[model samples]
Target: MSWTHTFTNLCDWYTHLLHNSPTGTIHIHILRNTITSNPDNVEHILKTRFDNYPKGKPFSTILDDRLGKGIFNVDGDYWKFQRKMASLELGSVVIRSYAFETVMDEIQTRLIPVMASKAHGENGTEIKTVLDLQDILRRFSFDINCKLSFGLDPGCLLPSLPVSNLADAFDLTSKLSAERAMNVSPMIWKMKRFFNVGSEKKLREAVNVVSNSANEIIKQRREMGFATRKDLLSRFMGLINNDDIYLRDIVISFLLAGRDTIAAGLTGFFSLLSKNPRVEEMIRKELNQVLGPDQESPTFDQLRQMHYLNATVHESLRLFPPVQFDSKHAEEDDVLPDGTIVKKGSRVTYHPYAMGRMKKIWGPDCLEFNPERWLKDGLFVQQDPFKYPVFQAGPRVCLGKDLALMNMKSVVAALVPRFDIRVVEPHHEPQFVPGLTTTFRGGLPVKVIEKKMLST
Candidate 1:
């Protein structure tokens, strides 16, 4: 199968492997050599046999031109330092105050309206496709990252095609990032770059777009004598003085981490909700129960109380993990539990999508989209992080997990209760497109209706 086709239908491939492979392990050489379908092996490769694995030169080379020495694309000391810096900056009170508020406002004011408008028309029939849901979420995340990181809102959230170079750049940058990530050889990557082949030109253009955009944010922040602002840029400025590369690296890293994943996540959640009426009804019921009959804008604490809402989100993520497949390099030769010897330079992947559907892991109802599986007795039950691995397992787990959940909770709480979403005509079955993040082949299209609660 073509790599592009694999990108879209990897889940089906996993299903095939699960049924056919005698031992649930396969050594496949396609886009890259991958070992998957064995959780014990996946765990051993990531944890017990970790030292044998590093991200390796091939992975680094593909991301080097655009990401520089940022955390996601780098390993060893560089990664450790970036990770430390990110943890500290994200933990600060300034980001907690203004950054989250900025994100919340964008979701409330910008994203919801765009979605609601697209679901309807003057004629009252569904406009369908709503191609802009993913687009709007990406812009929302980009704008949030811009403001939180630089004290500058790129205003990509404004009702229009994104005018800012940064916003436009991120759009293509993420796409190229996926393309480069799939290539297995350093020489092949160099060849691709040397000939301006494959997604190389697009990646380079995106790099320029993101670099210039970051530079502008930095320049403007400095020009304003940014002592008054306590956002992430100002904090980073405190760390490294006027080094442009440092500034650019931080901005791009934030952009890379923040964008696309949440968009894909939101896409999956809503898509699942569209198909699964019981899950949607239960979530909506929890919203009403927690927020009360007349409540519109729910507070954070109120959001936390919606147990079924959380379960629905969890189940959706289980079936369709945002980061579907993740790779770990075996640092040295090591034996996986299934007796497969992972060579020192081998790239091994754990497919969370496959894990979620594993009857052994989640029971015979694994393929069913049932949110209650997460609940025990009358309340929600939290699954083991290692077992689930949606936000990933071990030390390199996602940083934005809490914020992403909070953001998702807020959006779903506000939108799901207030609007009844229905899939629009000739309904396209949701298909996975795998790269860095899992996304649908075409965007999900749903018609939403404003729900009428009992008389106030």
Candidate 2:
């Protein structure tokens, strides 16, 4: 199989192993995990019998120190309460509008201008060389999330592209925490944490930086008064009466969710688009058709109406889900719909990363990045959640699905028509780094060509 040679691509390696398994499942005894790519098993774990598989204590303990009771790291009553409140806030039309406007403003004021400068080059020279597109997108995402989550502009995405300590700390902490999860035995990591040595000590220091930075944001909000602010942090502060730590966790959760996921999506999308210029051309053609004259960017409603762009984004996510795999522990011994036996207290993981490449689930050409798979009769058709649980499924589906899509679509709408991004190594498949979200190993280096639009 082609995936046999893709050892560097961890997801493809998993897909290769899963393909060989008769039940579309495998047990990595060393890691103490029962990983499955079967959609039936996924539906069973995520929806059909979700109660039996809350992110149990064992699963929560790994991320507990960093996430600290955030919405993504809690269970039972805590998860329910946070989910309810987050749903109310994220689902509100006003908040959605606020998020979209913030995204558009960031792209217009920061992202596009940066690309334009890069294309024009310094000293009147049209320099054609590699720029770390990944870094720029990450900065852009960080800035947008900071604005939406804390009402603070980190200025990380400015023309100078300054750095933020909180962002660097979060990156290190996420990398260390994910490393903890991949450990064959928890005892080693636990012992390190207890002794405060090695990676664990580094993790602790990074987390402290994050905590202290969060405190500053909260203090700033309180001092300035959150009465009329529309950001998530302000809204959360005004709505909840929790202690400062809990409030901090809530907003940090939003920042974590909003930042990396969008960057990952856009990164992977542009990477593929560079490899497939035909796809990029089709997208620009769709934009020309869907957007009217004098419209430099599509409005929220018009963005939603762009089926081709929607399908393209969905296709990118299928191939490169930000959170590639997720696990829920069994509270009691149970049998999955696919007849996979689950032992009490065992970690059962559903691998969206593998699922996307499964021949049975998505057909023989699953390895190909084809957006047409999502289209039907000239419009994009939604897939079943279990089959594509990239945003998760059932009760815990991502609250920011629409908002994330809007952010991505807005970036595409604003940039695709003006900039042509060419990946430095279009054919080289990137080995993903181990983190809470998908990130390329060496970052996506690219050459940006500014497109000239005819004056209307």
Candidate 3:
């Protein structure tokens, strides 16, 4: 059976149980507990009663083992400290410029070359089984993020697709995260820890690999200093004396946050663009119109000016949100509008993926891939962050929103004009691969026809 089938069956069962349960949260047979997919309830739980919910032990323990005490696993002051540090570094103009240029460099220098070779060698035939566009994209993102976060590029996008010791660490780490997310037996979890099980051993090794790499990068940055570049690594290195654990937390935090989320977003965007030629054409037209005929790398202003492209991105995100579901634990007892009381220690889930499908919030045509909903009267209308929930909402919204947009726009701007993409298999259907982020299950295979340049 397909992966989507398994997920759907699981969702169906979970939805049914949550639908009948009196409380907003229900302990699942697989996962420890799940919070129902209610918009208002999600808002209240995540925003209004935000203080009540922390990341929680069940969620924390598994990820903590691999990620260490990073922001994703930690709550309260540690999360706040890490979040502040990341924002200060990531939110800067110089850092943003570096991020945009670095990603473009990868696309032009690394990514497009791979596709170009494939297209040329295939003799115009469809490049069947891109295998894992998500993986390739992951490599690209990881490489760029390394440059941004560590001031050193790991070069994961090399010609041979060399094994990334760091990427491999992330692989094992995320696998354990998924296993733990399903709420494995605590007794088993403890016993595994006690006995030093294979999985646990693997988890520790992965964490050590990541930590050692991060520490080396930290050490390197301190020695060299940020005399010229104003990258994130420089910023962290400047404040290394603030607290060693805090510095470690920030590196791992950005590492986890940057790697998969943007790749997932781009994977969905490219998959949809392949199937929907009109969307691709519109995006290209907008890029040309806003960026001029030369097809230059988009500036921050030009990136913002390509409103339709942004909408296309938003629409894609609506359908395939990277973090499909976000979980939080209620700190104090609360009552949801559905009359489902959430106990103080109960878990809550907000399904942005499911919310995009809900006819009530997203209107009647929720499932349709229409960027027009995000555009109003021929102009792109920025929707409330709450309604979209793609980058998330409220205080904990994604810090890398601007950076993600800038990088995505850069790639699309670079490639779309030069190539016409055709989805090779199962046109119009999105295959779901559930990981830390949702990606196309079999990889998005598309035939690329080098676009004929018009004589001006």
lDDT by residue for model 1 (1-456), tens: 563355447566765676466666667755445656676776665666555666777677666777787777778887787778878877666666665677678877887776665554334554444453555666777777767666677788776755777676676676677776655655665677789867777788778877876788788777777677767777777676758786678667776666666777877787778778788777777777777877677776676777787888888899878887777776667777877666767777777877787877788998888988888775888997756888875667777777777777777877776676665633565676545777666666566665643344
- lDDT value for candidate 3? 0.72
What is the C-alpha lDDT profile of model 2 across 398-422, one tens digit per residue? Answer: 9999999999989988888788888
By TM-score, who's the top model here?
2
Per-residue lDDT of model 3, residues 1-68, tens digit only: 34345545344344444445554235543443555666667667667777777888767776766666
Model 3 weakest lDDT span, ten residues long: 120-129
Evaluated at residue 376, the lDDT of candidate 2 is 93
| lDDT head-to-head 2 vs 3, winner | 2
For model 1, which pairs clash?
51-331, 52-330, 52-331, 52-332, 53-329, 53-330, 53-331
State each model's C-alpha RMSD to the native.
3.2, 2.7, 3.4
Residue 365 lDDT (model 1): 92
TM-score, cand. 2 vs. native: 0.95
Clashes of each: 7, 0, 2
Q: How does each model score on lDDT? A: 0.71, 0.88, 0.72
Let me know the TM-score candidate 3 reaches against the reference structure.
0.89
Models 1 onward score TM values of 0.89, 0.95, 0.89
- Best lDDT goes to which candidate? 2
